[model samples]
Target: MVWDDFAINNLAIYLLDKPNKDRKVALFVKGCDSRGVVRMLQDNQIKRENIYLIGIPCPGLKDPKTAARGYYKDAGSVPEAKKCEECRHPNPVLYDEILGTPVEEPQEKDRFAEVNELEKKSVDERYAYWTAQADKCLRCFACRNVCPACSCPDCMFDCTKPRWLDKEVSTEQNQFFHMIRVWHVADRCIECGECERVCPAGLPLMQLNRKLIKDINELFGPFEAGLDLEQRPPLTHYETGDPEELM
Candidate 1:
């Protein structure tokens, strides 16, 4: 079988499309890629029985862009990709077969350090911070294209029927888009960091994602999305004990 490096997001995506729906497929997955698979399965976008998974223990990848620019003279000196530095799962969570020795998971660090710091800011300060990020947006939609959770057949932003959003690229419009996008995947985000990595604006999209994730955990008990097959996202299901304010 032919094998080559492929973008994890691309492979994990398209599984939701009609072309792949009926086929029995085998997928090679890293930690992030495996999470995407779990996301699709939990969303009922793909059937687990039709697929085989080969897991790889990821040691994190070097930043190709920086390496190509000769940011480091030696391979060993190249820093790990920013996304991988914060990765909680270095070994695939679900796989039919695994290859290579399982790498030791990184020491648990506070994943929400940035989010917690931002929470200490006043409401106006938070708004100003987000506004600045929105102003830098090019509206290229690269983040959405690479997102595994955004597998809708017809995206609302692209619809012409109601003309929900215009082509205007103002800061206001950009903020609207970003907020809507984040909220849509807030509960289901796999923490793959593809959105921030692919963004041309270099926006800290993960901050927004993690902020929501933090809030969800606090409100509904500690939970991680796409990690368990049986546990549903807290936001997706209703519990009688859930906060009355939520209703």
Candidate 2:
């Protein structure tokens, strides 16, 4: 019942230290969280035998900040999280035990609708739009911290040997940080939108992530990361027949 009250996708599983190999664990998962677990298993970060997944069909989650502000007259009137509104997968793809009857997944609509609109703008317009968004960045790293895909033992942001990012926060530095961060996770992003929700400045981080997803789909032919545990990420595999756009 606790899991039913909140969208567990907002919780960052990687932040928890690795569990003992002999210890078994059980947790509730929504569709996206299930994908995160699959990704961890695929990366050899966790063993499938060490965990039990209890799946729940997520209707959506209320925006906690909005609810705190008294934006809704009652609990029933609370708005769904933006990511949930656009979510294509509401039922867990993989689960050891399902807790409810499977809800019908949303119809296949243009998930990249916002990204497509951004693409229609002139190059300069797009640049200006992103620059303004980047200007508000605090370099807080909340986005990176909340991401399940960012499981590096030592993150590049914290590296000092080559100093990937400068200590000062500026528009240029923020832009570079976001650009590189998105690229690093581009092939693995599950589109849970936790990064945007956790952001203090309210940057539309999903738009940047989805843009990369759109490009990857077009160039590599409709690849969705974290959907199938057996599938290799498009960027991780090389094919001779791959498009020459980057070449």
What TM-score goes with each of the models?
A: 0.92, 0.93
Quick one: how many clashes does candidate 1 have? 0
Cα lDDT, model 2, residue 99: 93
Candidate 1 accuracy as lDDT: 0.83
Q: What's the alpha carbon RMSD for model 2?
A: 1.9
Index of the highest-TM-score prediction: 2
Over 34-129, each residue of candidate 1 has an lDDT whose tens digit, in order, gives 888888888888999988999988878755555666756786787777888899987888899999989999998788999999999999999999
Superposed Cα RMSD, model 1: 2.2
